[model samples]
Target: MAFEKGGENAYDVVIIGAGISGINFGYRLQERNPDLSYIILDGRHEMGGTWSLFQYPGIRSDSDLYTFGFPWRPWTEETSIAGGPLILNYLKESAQMYGIDKKILFHHQVNAANYSSEHKTWSFDVTANKTEKKTFRSKFVLLCTGYYDYHEPLKTVIPGIDDFKGKVIHPQFWPKDLDYANKNVVIVGSGATSVTVVPAMSRTASHVTMLQRSPSYILSTPSEDALERFIRRWFPVYYQHKLIRWKWIAVPFLLVTFCQYFPSLGKKMFRSATEPQLPPTVSYSPNFTPDYNPFEQRVCFCPDADFYRALRSGKASVETGVIEKVTADSVKLTSGKELHPDIIVTATGLKVRVGGGIDVSVDGKPYNVPEKYVWKGVMLQDLPNAAFVIGYVDASWTLGADATAQMICRMLNQMKKEGVDEIIPRLSDKEKNTMKDAPLLRLKSTYVKKGKDVLPKAADRGQWQARSYYWKDYLLAHYGDIKSSIEWNRS
Candidate 1:
């Protein structure tokens, strides 16, 4: 069923991705006003977004389950920090329980959406079910479509990959029935995907070799417990936001602060703390560099679970080396070591593609997403009647999106109350000139940037602007309002 193209009716709002972000956007709006008309569209055959496509072994979220799950629905005792399948089931369950499944059109890939100035409606051309092509129209379109692709495996060149006789696969598109029970596996990359595979395959595979370009500092924390809940309830929303913000700030702040305050003494004290954590056999190298701080890029891993279990069992090993080439049955490393493997998993990380690889244009002029400054990281200054939901990376995905959705809902309510039919975030020329992106290495989101502005600035590192502190942001957003936080418009 197409939107307006269905002849008689069109939803007031249409969400492009059915993942947690899009689904929450729908739920939040519906809860705010049950009469609000909307439908969610996903490219996959099912409702789960990333959780559905990434079927690799031991695929589970790095974040805690408490806030990561959903806004209205707490991850009850039966469901918690889950694997891919469990999360996918949760999405399905949410869709079913919310009565969103009927409205969600699966396997419907939205190719492009154009906003009409005169009509103030979005015209969308979508490839549905990979067979029939059609167009749908809506008053507003939410690009909830996340960074990952559903149709194919991300391509990576390993030189002699074609010559390798063993089966090869990307973590995003693993073959379900492929047997690796007694296989020797060599997985490339040290990102989240690689961390998951190391422990999972260890249970069946004879051995799993992990290769990485450089060593990333790893840390762990408990998923959920009484202490966190107490913190959630004990502090006022604003105070809690301040505390978490300071917590994020304290890491690099203390380092940068002490170094400047007591140059000599602080330098000595810094080494005393960090040096003990380095592997005893490996000497400390000043080259250990993190542009911002230890947890800057995203810190997710089960504390003393999969990653720890794999290391303790000696079934999984880590090596800092690049892949030089691939052979018929082995991979050649830059260090001249040869690894013969039965399966090679390219956990090399996912490529970020915003707008589902569809180009965004305004008045026939092509515009890049990063070229514009992100207003509260949701509204693009120059876009009218539009908002995209962003997920939590360090904290909880649902929490971040929930706040974004709330703010947008507030904007919509304000617009209606004030007789306004439009709202747009217009960028100032100076703001655009100073516009900077968060660096690619330190960011895992779909948007790309040249410098540090892409991630939340250190000065703005609290619940509203910080990237890693999930609980802080989740709580703040749940109670926050966008109408108060955002600059809007009226008719």
Candidate 2:
């Protein structure tokens, strides 16, 4: 059903967020069951969740577009690492192409959702543009919130930060008119945002300094994939796209496997990729090389070696040290060095929120999200008629998302055949205990570490553990028995 303002609340399914995952879920679910009534809701003023929110300098996709793009929709963009504007356009085009644009409600934020055991429906209380609470009802709720807190980034308190005189900006809330031209800029944190901003800002700014407490493995990739370009030029559009997509998909699997089995080899290869890009005067040890093994934290990807090029051109530089204090004109380092800057950008990671930070209750009892175990990395244990669109840490986020969408579609279709009203993945007492003892996310990133307590933990057995490989996920999504793990109830 197309979404209308102040329309009826009832639906077969309600998908939250109009981001990459939500748009795909709406398209895939409808493709599976055309008669299924569904609506896409987003709190933003328009479509494109992450693509719309982040308007910082040089914001781009960390993963290549072929693997990141939906399987049904081939990404025809020439560049593998797309700029934010291009990515936003791709999302908007997908929405319009799949008829999902008509099914979306802007300025509608899901506040809370409650599951009724007797009625076998999900009742959602949402606030429109922070006012006018509305009620929506659906048999199933699909959370495509992307796991991050949109309201605020993961801002860590730094001593003497208040004393800094220059304009301090977080990439999440980048000011449009903030003049940085001819100004010295200092960016803190060594993640994706830091690497992206350093090169972009350095082009216009007088000087840019990337100050990091620790280094992360950063690799420079060509903006366009050579193989994808060749295929696009030689083969038919359909064949070219599919072949290139599978090739990009296999690249990540091999990289991750090599990193897991041979740590030294992975580290050497990663270092070698960046070493040639740096100037001879600059050393790779302290500021460029990370002490941890490859894949411990996410590998930061920069296109066309822009970050390295900026450093070589003497427009930007890197500093690895702890912050002692932030003076009015400079940031004092623990190593007794100070960096004078006119602008400071905080590239510190994101704050992940489970279930879009919406208060959820089942059977009138407040449900603790972190306490639950995930089944097939989609549905939470004992959460009837619900699934979260979470992605893989190892590969393109959409690969896992696509797999989960297919799995949900299969489950919903099977439930209809069996005349089941409520479906919940339940674990025994022993299984619950096992999950409680394990970590929710295995990543070593700062954002994951900070929000681990509030995320869903993966179980050790069955369809509970979060699988990273796409082929394994595809086989399970297409052929796995849903009834073996789920508890089905009839109306």
Candidate 3:
């Protein structure tokens, strides 16, 4: 049910972004409050935002699908890592099944949003198909715009790049027609993107070279197991979801918490069991050690048998040096080696974009997001009548997103019962400083890391104190253990 259409328009919430995170949030909203009037808007034409846009060959989820997929739904497939199309299809089916598809508006991209101090509402300008602009007002603005936009080619400024006669492509924007068959390829960056492409291009490409300045902390894990198969086959959907959630998610989450607090024990255990999984040629130097735990910075992928097969095929190789220059047909390595290349895939990785390009303001001025602080990394503290749905970098993004959903429900309940007109989380000077002192995910490179100013950081709990793992996050938001750290009450 919706309100009468007239001059007066006020929806319960307006959710931006229709990716996995936003889609899940929208479904949860209606499930919790069936009568709540809301809209899920996205800039793209399809329901699967990232999965749709990223159609490069061999794109797959690094996180295991069981927990990483969705809470209400479990991945029924036998494969451990769900590829782009499969994941996209799953999201589409999930949306349709829950009736969240009706609330979605494609091609409707949000440009800016202003929070009204008086009305306690959010005003937004949505542009669709470039020319059509529409205005809407909502009691609560939910920014589910996944991260920031795609990171364009890196700022590395590789010399002679223009001279390269061959094609240069970023994995995010790979054209469908670009063929790698029988072509020699030089890929830039050793992050997740490069790692994924190595095995994929090796299958058909004559030769594939991975260029890296410094090696990333990459680890491997199996995609599926016999036990997982048996459980899924025997169990009901809800039962499977719970079992998979706890087994895959809860265990890892607790381990992450243990590691953060007790680094020595965590490191010792991981090095013993996890480190052995890496090929003998792999590096485990402290330089590559993430500022946080193993899964803290980003989840490393384990590509069942395919990754190893690619490595054994000799078609896949790695180069650890800077690129001094690129010629039309050759790349000059920092080590003074000129390697000929037929194709150059600059898989240099992506950057973070905050609030999916939505403008956030406080006190009639542009909000300095990183400085303001976070309410569990989802809701903005200083902003009024707004909350965002962002995922974790390490663990399953859905875990953090799920927590945000639960917390928003609690916040809504409190608002209804308390008649709260406003909410602003005020952190003491010391508490605020502490939050700034320790960030959950930290990467130094300008290309890989989100700029402190524009994109902003999730002023969230210390990944150590508050693990990004699913179960702990569920408990943190559900029970509110971090209450001392948060400031909440009736307006």
For all candidates, the clash counts are: 6, 0, 7
Q: Write the per-residue lDDT of candidate 3 for residues 1-491, one digit (tens) a residue.
A: 12213354457778888888788888778877665678888888888877888977789887778777777776777666778889999999999988889988888878888876666667788898878989878877777777657444344567888888899888888989998899999888777777788888888999888877776556666666666677788997668667765777756667666866887776566566544443555445532444445544554565675554565567876677778888778998878987888999887666566787667665457776666556566665577767777677657777777888877766665665566655655566666566544453444544545455554345444422323445556776767743444444443
Better of 1 and 3 by TM-score: 3
- The residue-level lDDT of candidate 3 at 453 comes to 59
Candidate scoring better on lDDT of 1 and 2: 2
CA lDDT for candidate 1: 0.63
**Model 1 lDDT tens row, 66-123:** 4566746555432234687777787778877877777788888877777775666676
Instruction: Give the distance in Å from residue 449's predicted Cα in candidate 3 to where it truly belongs.
Output: 3.4
> Which regions in candidate 1 have their CA more than 4 angstroms from the true location?
1-9, 78-80, 152-157, 221-292, 359-367, 429-491
Supply the global lDDT for candidate 3: 0.70
Best by TM-score: 2
Worst 10 residues of 2 by lDDT: 1-10
lDDT of 2 by residue, 1-491 (tens): 12112448788889999999999999998899776889998989988889999999998998999988888888987778999999899989988988889999999999989998887878999998888899999889999999899998897887798998889999999999989999999999999999999999999999999999999998888877677678878998769888888888888889989998999999999878878999876789898888888887888888888889999999999999999999888899999999999999989999989878899999889999888878888899889999998887878889988999999998888778888878899887666556444555657888998998889887667667766578988998999777767798876
Query: What TM-score number comes out for model 2?
Result: 0.96
